[model samples]
Target: MSKNRYSVGLIIVIVGIILLLGKLGVFGFVWGLFWPVFVLAPGLLLHFLYFNRVLPSAVLIPGGILVTCSILFFLCTIFGWSLMAYIWPGFIFAIAVGLYEFYTFDKYSPRGTLMAAVVLAILSGILFGVTILFTVGIYLIALVLIGVGAYIIFGKRRSW
Candidate 1:
């Protein structure tokens, strides 16, 4: 009769059905694909609790981080794990997202929260650039050099 009981019952029934379907091969592809949702759901629940005023706004930080990490995890699952080498910057960006969310939502946020968020975002960008450069090898450097050369040739000259 209580909300908790109803929620538990619903969850049990849904899980039971899913297991049944899995045994029957009805969810062959979907069964394996959705495992990351388990990691993502808790993050979403935290955000929902924060919005509903059941939890403090501070929850946004971990919630954002978890959600971002879960998405990246899912990507790693779908793509090859080798992609993780280049995508590791996502972990830094996840923290940045969490910090930014906390800064935006917490009225009494710490003084350096915004600064920390900005720094983390910049660090994430730098890491991502470095990763791309490493992954792409000399091509990226050549492209940059060509762009610089084109700028020097065609860019407007300014008087100093």
Candidate 2:
């Protein structure tokens, strides 16, 4: 009887605390910032499962994609959505990461998947560079070129 009474008392206290926290809006604040952890947790769990040999290595494909994309999402959320324009190629890079993980962990260790991963990685790199060049990077590149040209025109020529 005392045990039952104690349990009921603990439950009432816990419910009171939860109600107080909810009324204070802590849930909203925490959810807004940490929602992506929902996405990241399953990916990490899949990785943990595979590493523990409880699941097949194939799970790594989705695991890698989820983990990578979650990190990217977290970065965008923390910084600003505008950064997505500069970093959109990261989606392609996420696929490459998934394929690379699958290639790495699979028993067959297929070469084709590795090649695909490499190609996707290189493509993502090229796209990322091009996107940068089209955005703020153009101004930076122009500034560098102008500085070099000004030095060449105004400074004495050195014998090489």
Candidate 3:
């Protein structure tokens, strides 16, 4: 399928699932919220495979791995799993991405990549804090905004 067609179908499925889960209850809502990890990791790898000739692999790979790990951590926490083992790896992925972006800024779209990294770092902290504090309202807001930002920034269709 064309990239645009695939992206549109993905978006429609995601939105449909979210709406269905939201109508169910807290558990469904929570599950829907953390579902993106399963969506993103392969999506990133696929993007690398399909579009590398057009866009640098470095630009998308680290961000994809970090996002995938982070989302896995969140889902684990929701399932009452202790995230101690996963946390450090996720943090490392994030830091590696940040450092990579910093060091390679001049090689690509420096401003956009750096800004995205900074925002993701800040957001990772905010989401971790809000989750730990049991701040559901703030967590939901931060989560939604991050979700929207990710879709806009990374989705192949450029929904933004």
**lDDT score for candidate 1 against the true structure:** 0.92
In angstroms, how far off is 133's CA in candidate 3?
2.0
Q: For candidate 3, lDDT tens digit of each residue in 1-160?
A: 6999999999999999977767778666666567666655664664555355665555454555556565666666576466653344456446546445444633545456666666667766766765555635667879899999999888887345
TM-score of 1: 0.71
Provide the TM-score for each candidate, comma-separated: 0.71, 0.84, 0.32
Model 3: runs farther than 4 Å from truth? 1-41, 50-106, 135-160
- Write one digit per residue (lDDT tens) for candidate 1, span 49-114: 999999999999999999999999899889968889999999999999999999999989999999
Tell me the tens digit of each residue's lDDT in model 2 across 1-160. Answer: 9999999999999999999999999998788788889989999999999999999998998999999999988998899889999899999999999999999889697769999999999999999999988887879988999999999999898889
Model 1 lDDT at residue 83? 87
Clashes of 1: 0
For this target, which candidate reaches the highest TM-score against the unseen true structure?
2
Worst 10 residues of 3 by lDDT: 84-93
Query: Which is superior by lDDT, 1 or 3?
Result: 1
Native-to-model Cα distance after best TM-score fit, residue 84 in candidate 3, in Å: 16
- Looking at model 3, residue 71 earns an lDDT score of 68
